[model samples]
Every structure is written in structure tokens, then in C-alpha cells.
Target: MIIRYLGDSELAQVRRRRWRKVFYVIDDDLMRLDDDRSVPEDYRQRLLAFRQKRLPDILDLADVIVAPNERILEGYPSKKGERLDPCYVTVCDDLRHFDDYQTIRILFPGSRSHLNDLAFLQEGLLRLSAAHTELEIVTYMGANAPVRLKGMEQIQHRKPLPWAAFQKEQQRERFHICLMPTVATPFNQARSINKLFDCAAVGAVGVFSRGGPTDGVIADGVDGLLVDHDVMAWEKAVGFLIDDMARAKTMAQACLDKAGLCGNPVRVRDFWRKQLDI
Candidate 1:
């Protein structure tokens, strides 16, 4: 059983080899690659070319198709005789519990591709920084600390690390809040709930965009706050969480509880076991 993650350039080559049980995991809706406003122009153009030239051949060779969620499957074209069997495998990382700290540590753990999303919260974040002296911004994955955030004294930037190291370091650092702002584009809409789980694993309350991929997972005002994709709404949510430390802590704990039960590693392992028939 060969498990193929998205973005592997050698899929067509793999197909030529005729491997047994080749499963392709579609992490994002590649059909909307053109609509991704966050990716660099050259990279996006190259990706579009690759998809156009190689996708049909790869699809013909794939035995099973997997997606992060049900919604992502809607992006694929329907097959005539052969039904496209799309499996939903959510991102399930290990869960971690941490102690709350004095300073309000906010995190934006996205790659450079999240430029548009981060831009949406620029004004709100700046306002938050100005109002709260204890606000600290931690960025990773080559995500430059927003220029608007440079004026703030408490901004910290860590170079990107391997996924395993990131999880360990994130839990150890124990940021209070995780900001996950998204735009209303096709690429953004088809995103998975990975960010929600990433924040939950670190015992951080996630402030996400309303009606995004995480809508069904996060209960607004309960485990997390889901606000409209606007600066004012983001500011209000951030301020509300900052002013009430106790509530923020509670929300963080609640997030961990929900994610632990629903997105446990055991569950993910079992899913893989059943899917792979190991």
C-alpha cells in the first residue's frame, strides 16, 4: 500500500510503475489553485501548469482517492464508469496540554501561502498590540512577522521546524491564542480543519473565520470564537479573549477536551488500519 500525499511531483512516474494499491491524498482543492491569493505568482503558475498537464494521467493511475474532508471531494470531476471513491482523513496530530502563562501569547502558524489571510487581520492585530502591552506575536513556517506587527515590542519569529519538532515546541511554549484568519476564496473555502486541531493540540484557543472549513468542528463562544472575516470583528474577538484570561484558559481546555475525544491519535491510527487493511 503506497500512501501518496499531495504535491508529490513523481505521481505520474509512480503510476508508470504500476504499484499495487496506490492511494492519492488530496489535501486541498487543487482545482482552485488559480484562486489561491496567498501563494507566490511564479509558484502558483508552475502549480497550475503541473496540474493541467499531469493530473489526468495521475487520476487514471490512482487506485483510491482520499481527501481531508467531504467538501474537498466536490472539487474533483466526476468519472463516467469508475466512481471516484474519496476518503475523508482529517489531520490528526498528537494532543498536548500546557500551563497558561502571564503574557497573552498569540500565534499565526501559517506558511507564506497565508499572506492574504494574515492581511485580513493586520489592522485588528495592530490595534490589539497597541491596546495590550503584554501581547506577543509568534510566527513560524517562513511567515514573516507582519510589518504592522514590527512596531510592537513583543514580536518573536522562529524559523520553520520539522512537523514533529513544531508540535513539541508549540506545546512547550504554550501560546494562549492561535489566530487563523481566512479569506472567502475557493482555495480557502476548501481548506481542512488542520489549524483548528493544531491549536487544540497545544491547548490554545483558536480564533477562526466564520463559515470556514472549521465551522462544524468549533462551536463559536464555547470551545473557540468564530468571527466574521473583518478587522473589527477580529479585534473584538481578540480583545474579548485577552481581557478575560480565565475564560481564555477555559476555552483552551475545552478545545483540548473536544479534540482529544474526537481527533484522538488512536482514532486516526484505527482509521488508517481499516483503510489499509493492515
Candidate 2:
């Protein structure tokens, strides 16, 4: 039986209803449960209390629990003889293909929630634009993106494309690269598979930070180039590719071939089939 916490995405709800034929665990918001006190009066109190009392029992009956990340698994203890059945799927969508543009396409927008570091992207794009007229840096800026770079000709701000469309665009480019320059932080260290797979699947060589989850996906100077989180290093890597098309194509092909083994759904499915004896 497939079960999910209520109030999740409509797509998930529809899937659960259609395939599993099960009831969703309708629970009131429990974000306050970690606090020391009970919630104040609310219409959801009954649902909240019921969930608090019966969640463990519900989990015990579940054949498999899909947790978004490892942190969620911490709360659910394994029964004495029963192994915990949990699986994780990265939220990022698979890559698609779009049209080809002549200029080098560098997509390096900072983390979605952090608006402060946009200046790095703007400055980096501006410097690259000045150095090479053939470069086109496309970034989707939020409503709060800095106004200082608004008038720059080469820096075009389009409406943020959906992930699928963005992946398609990455595929179409003759040369595309994803730059992730993370300021050292615990949060930055835990970035998921989105950036690595997105670029690699579409044959774009990644210029990623030398550490973090990216390190697991990228091989230094092999599938893609890895560099310290420094602006000069970023410029050199991107510049070398822009200047040497043959090397860039070779690296891009290597990334695409390697990504097929690492992130391809068919390969991943086979891996689990062997491990789980499916």
C-alpha cells in the first residue's frame, strides 16, 4: 500500500489514489511538535492529536517509507526483526533537449533561497562578457535581483524556465557549463544531485566546487573540471573551454558518457534490482 502524509503535491495525491488504493494520512500541521509546549486552540487540533498518537502505528504497517532525505528517517525506529524500508529519490527532473545557440552558455545562478550572492554571478558574467564578445550568460533573476547589472547588454534576464525547459536548453547548447561557487557552509555542502546530473545528462561539462556532493559525481579533470571556489579559477576553466573547442567537446562527451552510468534511470533501476533481489 502506498501512503503519504496528507497535503502533499496534488500529483502525489492522485498517484497514491490511483495506483495504491489507500487513504492518505490526513494530519494537521505538526511543525510545532518539536517545541516544548502544545499548540494553542485551532480547528486542526483533533487531526494533530490523532497523528501524534498513531503515526508510529501507521509507519509499522507501511511496507516502505519514502523519506525525502536521511533526516526524516531518524524519527522512525526499526522493529526488532523488521528492517527499515526507506528509499530516496532526488527531486530534480531528467534532462531534455532544446535549440542550439552560437555563444557559450554559462548558467550559474546561486542557490534559489539566497539572494545575497547574486552579485558574484553578475560580476562573473560581466567579466566574462567583457573578455569575450561571443559569450552569452543567461540567468533567471528573482524579483529582488540586484538592479546594478540590469542594463548590461550581454546579461539577459528571462522568466525562470521550468526545470525541464532549462535542461532542454542545456542539451541544445554546443557548449554549456554549470558553475556552482558555494561559499563554505554546512548547508552548501549538502546540495543534492540536481546540478550535477542536470549538466552531465545534457553533455555539458560542469565547473563545480571541489568538495560536497558534487565531488561524488564529478572526477577532477576527467568527466568534468573541478576547481577551488575562487573567481580566478572559474574564469580560467571557462576561458580555456571557450578558447579550445576540441577539448571542450571531448570533456563534454566524457561527462555525458559518465552521467549515463552514474545517474541514468535504467542503470539505477538495475542496480536496485540486483541489490533488493527484485
Candidate 3:
């Protein structure tokens, strides 16, 4: 089984080779293709001008089309012959081992590209560290992390490690949490649910913005906490968990239990197999 990404220019390459199965990750509505095309002159008004003859051509070539999340799947064109399904995987390193520290650790900073927006998380961390003198806040340093974070300077910063080491380290901690604050935009609205799965798998409490696909998975005050995009809210939430160890532990256990049922890789794979009819 060879997996290939079918993009605009790369769709033709799949035909050159033969494979048992091919998967394409579809992310847009076929009806909205005109909005994406480069054809000038009243493109919005000329919606009918751009015939969708090429859509079937693309779909016919694909053996299986995978949508990463429910949002992506919802946006996909549903037709009689089309076979679209959610077959996305959370590609984070498996953290099934390690049992050491009893301190809380937090992982924020969405991606390397938007480190500036993530600076607030570092600020929150500083405030957290100050209130709890004995707390150990481990910050995973991404390859593109900024030089410094206020109040986190004293907090231990570990270089990005191999998947095995990283997962081992993550599981050793008492709790793990992810804080992601996405700026309001159509593009940001398309965020993936993998972060929730990733944090849940390791029994880490997940903290995220109420926007995007997070709402579908995280139930505030239930499985995880949802915060407004304000730094104060983030700080308060983090502090609450850090101060209340028992509640944090319970939430972590709940996350682990839920993740085992819903985000299990084997279960996810079986879902894909059923969807793809393989």
C-alpha cells in the first residue's frame, strides 16, 4: 500500500505508478473550487462559468480519499460515487512509558511559525512558577522556539528529543497540558483534533481555545478545560490545575480512559479499513 498526496499539480503522478491502495487527503468543498482558482474577472459572480468537469476526473483517479477531521469531511463534496471518510492519524510520538515526576508540565506554542503569539503562554508559565515555588514547569523547546520566555527562564527547557525519549519524558511527568490560542480567521478555524488526542493519549489534561475542532472533543470542566483567548484566563486555568493536584490527576485519568476508547490507533485504523473497504 503506497500513500500519496494528491494535490493540483501532483494528481497526474499517481497514474504513473500502480499500488494496492492510494489515499488522498481532501480538505475543501468541490463546489467552492472556483473561489480557489486563478481565473480572473468576476470569479465570485462567474461561479457557473467555471464548470466542475475536472472534479470527477480527480475523484475517479483516487482510490481512497481521507479527510483529517470532521470539519474537513463536512466540507468535502458528498455524491453518489464519491468515497470520502475520516482517516486521519495523530502522528505524535507514543508515550506509553516512564513513571517518575509528580510535577505538572505544559506544552503550548502551536507551531514554529507563530512563536510570537505563543509568547503569552510563556508569560502565563512565569506567573504560574512564581505562585508555586516548588512546582517544576518543563517547557519543550522546539527547533524554532524564541530565544527567551519571560518567567520561564528558570523553568527547565529541554531540547527536542527523539520520539521515544520525548514520549518517555512526557509520560514521566505527573500531568501534561496543551494550550493553543488561535487567532480568529477562516484558516485558523480549520485546526486539527490531533492535539486533543495527543494530550489525551498521555493522560495529559488539554486546555485550548473554544474555537475550531476542539469544541467537538473537549468538554470544558469535563474531560478538559476550555479558556477564552485571554492570557488571564489561561493563567487562571493553569494555576487552578497546578494548585489542585487531586482534580488534575482525576482529569488526567479521565483523558487517558477516553483516549483509550476513542483515539486508540488500532480502533482508528479499523475505522479507516471499514471506510476504505480494504
Candidate 4:
């Protein structure tokens, strides 16, 4: 069996090959490209030509179809296609959770493209920062971060690092809470639970936007906090964690426990075997 992780050109080369082929669809390129207003004006045409046009053709040749998230699977053409039971995969690694840290650290580890989503909470974050001097706001997106947080004393904006150095960054400085604020756009809806997994890896309890990728996993107020994309709600959720250290620790541990189930390599291997009928 041959597996292609969103490699349209590679899959195209082996279209009529004898071996079984699988295509993993993580993003709906058509939806993204079509929503030109939401997407950057500069990247629209290029993305449409390549991702929108070239990618979907590979789906027709695939013997099996796999998607990391359910929403991604639902976007596929249903008229005439072989769509298998979707396998939700998590990109998690074995990293020690430093939950016993003294100070409260809040992280927003997305790229500059996520600036649009974070704009909603900029005002709330400013208020939260001013009220709580002990809270530390950390972000890799320096200039892309909320304008009010740029020069704040409590907030620290570090330069973005490569994927390989992510664990190292986590090791050097542990965070207590990770914030993920997403809008209800097609692109945002199809996002994976990557941020949640990242937080669980480093023993950070995540506060995610409800109806986003973390829906199936996070049990609000238990493992993680799932709230609406409102300013006050985000502020309140962060405040709750800050005020109650014991609860925060419990939730962080719970999140790690949930992460263990999703991130297990053995389980993933078994799932692949079953999917491939090996």
C-alpha cells in the first residue's frame, strides 16, 4: 500500500499503478481559494492555480481516502468517489509536561496568518494583561501579534522557530496555558487539533474556541476550556485558570491523559494496518 500525505503531484505519477493508493486530505484547498476575500490577495491566484486545480484530481485515483479531521472529510465530492472511514491523526511527540512551573504563561504559537483570528481577542488580552501583572503572555509572532501586546512589560514576543526546534523551545521555557481563538470560517473549521496536542506535549492546559478542531477531545472545564470566540469569555476563561492554580494543574494533567490516548504510536500503527487491510 502506498500512502500520500496531500502530495498531489506524487500521487499523480502513480495514478494507474497496481499498488493500492491512499490520499490524506487535511485542508480543503477549494474552499480556501474560493474565499478570496478572507485569503490574502497576493496568494489567491497562485493557490487557486495549484492547490485548487491540481490537488482534487488526485482524489479520483485514490483507492482509499483518509482525513485527519471529520470536517475535512465532509468536504470531499460525494457524487462518485471512494471515501473510506476517516482516520483522525494527531502529531504528538513524547515531551515532559512541566506543569509545576511557578509563573503563569499563556501562549499563542500560530504564525502571522493567524493575525486575523487573534484580532478578536486583542482588546480582551490587553485588559487581562493590565489587571494581572503576574500573568505572562508569550507569542512567537512578534509583529503579527495584537498591537496592544507588542511593548507590554508582561508580554514577550519571540521570533518564530522551525518545527524541529519546537520541542527545544518548550524545554527551555514551559507554558501553563495555550490560547487558540478561531473564527467560524471554512478554513478555520477544517483545522486539526495540532495546537491542543502541542499544549498537551508541554503540560499546558489549552483554552480553545468552541466548534473548532478541539471539539471531540476537549471536555470543557475538565480536560480543557472550550469557549465562544468572544472577548469577555476569553478573558474570563484565562482569569479562572490564573486565580485557581490547583484546578489548572488538575486540568493540565487531564489534558495530558487525553493526549496519551490520541498520541499513542501503537494505536496509530494499528489504525493504519486496519485501514490498509494489511
Candidate 5:
């Protein structure tokens, strides 16, 4: 399994390694970097170069390309003409109880790459916060979190964590709701709802963008909520959860139940075993 963004020397070393099967995994939306202003120019240039050049070589060498969804596979077509199951695969069991809760907790659980998507929800978040004094918003963006929003008494920001640490933290802490809002760009369009899995892993009700991958999958107003690009819509979805804590708690458990069944690691392992024919 080769996952890192390696330099030429490292790439050559990877090629020289002896292995029965090679896998390349892409857990992000790597499309239309030039149009995404949030990405720094130099870094964007480097990413684009890698996407155009090194990606082909890596795909050619990889026995299978494991990705979060079909859109990514379509965006970066492989010679095999197929993509593996996303394999985000799992759920959290010991979920947080909502009874006796004083404050409504909401969190934006994403890395710097998701800042643009999170920003799309800023106005709505502000409006929602204004309406409810008991609401507490936690963000993982740290110093990079939106300045205006971070200054609010209800908003608290934490520094981004390493991948392993983030997963552990997801298990440790609990929030009532998780937010995923995205603007319509090729970059955002090609992304997956790994956020949906994250929502389940944290055992929180998810509020997703209507046109994104989570749209059809979420079963809105049941296990989760879906909002359009409208700021009022975003505010409304969250407001629904705040107004009805019992349903909100039910939805969170339903979301986790769905994840455990749909994203079972055992099922994933079996699928891969069959795919590998071993």
C-alpha cells in the first residue's frame, strides 16, 4: 500500500520494491485545482503537475486504485477501467446520549482541505448561532478557522489533528451534529461523502449539501438532513435538530446503525478478498 505523495527518488524506490500486489489510494477530490482559489498557487501548481504526470505512472503500476467514490475514478480514469470499493468502512458503538444536555453541540470535523466547503456555511452558521444562545460550535480548523465566526462566544476552534489522532478523537468526543457544506465546483462535485461516514463514526446527525454525494444516500429528515446552497436552508436544517432533540438523537443512532451495516470492515475485507482472488 503506497499512500504518501512521494518525490521522484521515493517513487523510484517504491517501483523497485518487491510486492505481490500494489494499491494506490486517493481519499480526496483532485480535480480543477486551477479554479480553486483557496489552494495556494505554488502548491496548486505542484498538485496539478503530479496529477497530470506522476498519477498516470502510478495508476499504470497499481494493481487496483482504491478511492472514496466513483467520481474520483471517473475523473482519473485508470487503464484497468475500474475502481475499487471506497473502503472507508465502520461505525461507533458507544454513542453519546442527548438527554439532560444543556447546550446543543455542533462540529465541523475536517482538515484544511475542507475550509472552502466549511466557509460556504459561514453565513448560515452565524444566523443559526444568533437564533440560539445555547448552541456551541466546535471547529477543527484552529488558527485557520474563519476569524469572524471564531470570535463568537459560542464558537470554539481546535487545531487540526494528525490522521490517527483525529480518528482517536472522533471516538473520544461526541457532538450532536456534524456539518458538511460544499459549493458547486468540479473539485467539490467529484468528492465523496466520507463525511457521512465521519458523521456516523462520531455518532452525530449529519447536515449535508443537497446536490452532493450524500444527497441521495442520506434519507433526509430521517437519519440525517440535506440542505441546498441557500443560507436559510442550512439554518433551517440545523434548527430542526435543535427544536427536536429526541428525533435528533434517534437520527444519530440511525446514522450509526446504517454505517455499521453498510461500511462493515468485515464486508470490506471479504470484498477485497474476492477482488484479489486469494
Candidate 6:
């Protein structure tokens, strides 16, 4: 799948060939190419040029546009956009459930692009970490993470790894809960539920933002918890799990079951078969 924006020669070559095209929309490039400050200015400018000149044509020529989520597909001008369901094959054998554990480890995983999202909910996270000495928050965001979470004894800052390395490494560590907070931005709105898959891999129950990506899908008090962006709301949502081990245990199992369904070998095989038309 051609996820990245193509160069001039590559575009020409693709245009010349009479082949089936599947364009994977990895990110909301239109929103980020110019505005994303995390990227270097020179690289951003070059990417913006490519996006402005070649992106429309790429979309126009694509036979299928594989979007990460329904929101992205809906916002996309192309009707060929298809939202992909994530399949998790790499899971940890021994998961540290909330039971028998004094410290509740909450994984707050994100990348450079998600700094703003983390920042938005930093206050709530700060309060939670401060109030609960037993609650530990783990993040792969490193020094780029929220300042509020810094210097906290419970907040762990792991060195960011490459995608492949991270996938393998994440399974090695055990987490009780996974925190997924999304800000209501165009770029964030277009994101996929990959975090849910990550939670599944580590056997952690998810606590995602209600109006964000987890909207309408996650059953409240069942597989996961859906919360608003409010400071108290986040604290309350996480605190519920921390206070009650039984509820957390049940939710973790339910969330694992849900993730199992998503990662079913036959289901994944069928999805790809249909998507690839093979």
C-alpha cells in the first residue's frame, strides 16, 4: 500500500502503469503537512509541496483508499475510503491483572504528534498521580510528555522505540490499564483505534475519551470506560478501577475478550481477503 506521498518520478511511473491502486491513508496529511510543528521546517515544506501538487491526483487515481478509521473516511472527499480494523497477533503470555497488585500501572502511550492530546488531559493525570501513590502511569512519550507528569514518582518515562521494536517490547511489560485521551482536533479525529489494540496486546483495560475515537463502540462499565475530557471525569474514571479490583478484573477480562474477537485469525484473514480482493 502506498501510504507516503510519492515523488515526481514515482508518481509518473505509477500513472504510466495500468495497475490496481490501494492507497493507505496512514495519517491526516492534509491537516499535518503544513501545521505540524514537530516535524522539521524543511521536511514539512517539502512534504507540503508534494501534498499540494500530488495528493489530489493520488486520491483521484486510487482504486481504494484504506483509511485508519471511519472519521477519516467520512471526512475524506473520496468515496472509496474503507476503515481498517486493527488485528493484534503479538500479545503477552503473562499479563499482570489488577488482582494481587498494590500498584495499578496505567499505560499513557503516545508519540510526538500526540503531545498536545496528552497536554490537554495533563491536569487530570497530575491530580490522579498525586492523589494515589499506588497508581503508576507509564508512557513512551519520554521528555516530550506533559510537564505536569514530570518529577512525579509514579510517572514513568520510557525511551521511545521504533514501531517494530515498540510492538515487541510493549508485550514484555505488563500494564493494568491503558489511558487513551484524544483532543477534538481534525488530526486527532482522523486517528484509528490502534491504542485499543496496544491495550489488547498488553492485556490492559482501556479508558478512552468518550467523544473521541472510542465513541459509540466501547460499552461503559463493560469492556472499557468512556470518559469526557473533563479533569474530574478522567480522575473519576481511572479511580473507579483503582478503588475496585473486582470491577477492574472483570473489565480487563471483557476487554481482552473483545480484543480477542478483533484479532481472530479467521476474521483477520477474511478482512484482508476482502480488502485485497484475493
Best model per lDDT? 5
User: Candidate 1's residue-wise lDDT over 129-229, tens digit each?
Assistant: 87888788877734455666554566666777777787677656667789998788877776777787677655689899998878888899898999997
Give Cα-based local distance difference scores for all models: 0.70, 0.53, 0.55, 0.68, 0.76, 0.74
For model 1, what is the error of residue 42's alpha carbon versus the real structure, in angstroms, after optimal superposition?
3.4
TM-score of 4: 0.80
- Give per-residue CA lDDT, model 6, range 74-142, as digits (tens): 646645776766677665454446556687888877766677767777888888877888888888888
lDDT of 3 by residue, 131-173 (tens): 7775555555554455556335446555656656765654554
Tens digit of lDDT per residue, candidate 5, span 1-278? 66736568867988887877777777555666767766435656878888888877776668766776677666555434344434343466755558655888898886777777778788888988898999989888888777677788999888989978888888777788999886776667767667877888777898888888776678888888888888788888888899888999999998887666556677668866876776
Off by over 4 Å in 2: 1-102, 109-111, 114-118, 142-144, 164-174, 270-278
Model 2 Cα lDDT, one tens digit per residue, 1-278: 33444333543545444332222222122333344122223423544564676554554344444332232333344521111222122212232222243666766544343243355455666688898887766556645456866777776666666756765664554336666665544334433545665566445677777764466667777778887767777788888777775666666667776666665576545644653567
Output the worst ten-in-a-row residue range by lDDT, candidate 1: 80-89
Query: What's the distance in Å from true for residue 76, model 5?
Result: 3.8
- In model 2, what is the error at residue 116, expressed in angstroms? 5.1
Give the TM-score of each candidate.
0.83, 0.62, 0.65, 0.80, 0.89, 0.84
lDDT of 4 at 200: 72
Candidate 2 vs candidate 6: which has greater lDDT?
6
**Model 6: number of backbone collisions:** 0
Best by TM-score: 5
| Candidate 5 runs further than 4 Å off | 7-10, 17-21, 38-43, 85-90
lDDT of 4 by residue, 1-278 (tens): 33433355666567646665554434443544475345444545665676556556655555454655555566565522333322223322332434344557888877555666677778888898888877788878766566766888888888877766865666555577888887777767766666776777566788899988888789999989999978899999999988887788788888877777666667667776776678
Clashes of each: 0, 0, 0, 0, 0, 0
Full ranking by TM-score? 5, 6, 1, 4, 3, 2
- Name the TM-score of candidate 1: 0.83
Look at candidate 2 and give me any clashing residue pairs: none
lDDT at position 236, candidate 5: 83
Give per-residue lDDT, candidate 6, residue 247: 80
